[model samples]
Target: MHAMKLSAAILALLLPLGGCKLVPTDKPDAETAAAQTDEARMAAYADENWSTKVLPVIAEHTVDYDTLQKALSAGVETAGNSYGLRPEGEANPWNFVVSGAGTVTEAKLDSRAARMEVDMNGDGKPDVTLQIGPIIRGTALRDAMPFIVFTDFRDQIEFAKLARAMNEKAHAGLDIPEGDVIGKTVSFTGVYTMRSVDDAPEIVPTVIEVDP
Candidate 1:
């Protein structure tokens, strides 16, 4: 009986030592805050990368008006679609990255940069009309090539979002407030989408430099 009591006392002492308390392991507030900060930085970097690298790439590869005019004359399906045309893709008729600079003959008066005509040839004649938008519409710039696919962005939705962001950023860079760019000698490098030869080869310039 004495031995049994001794054994029972030892068991009781060991049981108390072998206990585990449930502790709630939750996400730390600091960790979440740090993660958000990092995400913001990454997003800012993406914007800058697109503006500096992607837009410029499109600009550098832009075809002149004469070449573009010819290409449009020849159907995009033919040998004309030379500079990475994405006509068969989602953005139909293809988005042509075009570069030209000349006097702004007219500006559609509005808060946004819409329907600004440019005399690209400087022959005292306006060859192509450009669209500067309160909302710069189209996915031509994004799909002008294969590199700027959904893989470049976070997802399919992000890809579209990137396009909108790019347009907004491009418009901001042009900075034609109150349609005051009229009669100014401005050079622009932007994207052109042509649905047909009849399509008014409107340029949506990613870059615009005011000469005078």
Candidate 2:
């Protein structure tokens, strides 16, 4: 009888111990988690519509010879002044030569702001430009928005890894055209903030007209 009672007690102890065994719970897989992250990032990049808010503001400013010269000079100065220390054999305060014209190609709204491409001149080539502006109007609130513009070359490098991944998935081909590529459209992506001439903000002009 003692043995029987002991066995019953042992069984009861085992029952509770068995309950402690770990059981796997349903969780998102790695792929699912990655996809979720990508979706979130893409959404963040597309939240602002620059065409509706910012482009009109810049376009209204108008482009002329004087403005184009000023803008080009600004770009050159910004690039030259970058990194503080000048490298060996670097040209002294280089300036962007008027390559030609650029036109607006596509404007997509994203979380970061909006991406726009404009062909400053009427050539087939489009000058890549990005515009950042307020989603809604408010004085202090406007400061929160980010606006940025990039050259097509710069944009291409910026999106290189992502573009490559996209190409791999879509199996699309890229064309390489010949001749003077200086004026060719470049790609850029980033948030931008608007600043008046007095502030001397580092911004590429929206309207660029290349001089012949």
Q: Of the candidates shown, which would achieve the greatest lDDT relative to the real structure?
A: 1
Give one clash count per candidate, in the order shown. 3, 32
lDDT of 1 by residue, 122-173 (tens): 6777777766775776766655654555654556665666666666656666
lDDT of each: 0.66, 0.34
Residue pairs whose backbone atoms clash in candidate 1:
113-132, 114-132, 190-205
Error of 1 at 16 (Å): 14
| lDDT against true structure, model 1 | 0.66
lDDT of 2 at 136: 18
Residue range 1-212, candidate 2, lDDT tens digits: 99999999999988988669688876678655555544343333333434464444334322342344456456544533331112133442221211223444554434333334555446654433433322211121122222422232234444333222322211111122233334345332121222322322222332322222
Clashes of 2: 32
Top model by TM-score, which number? Answer: 1
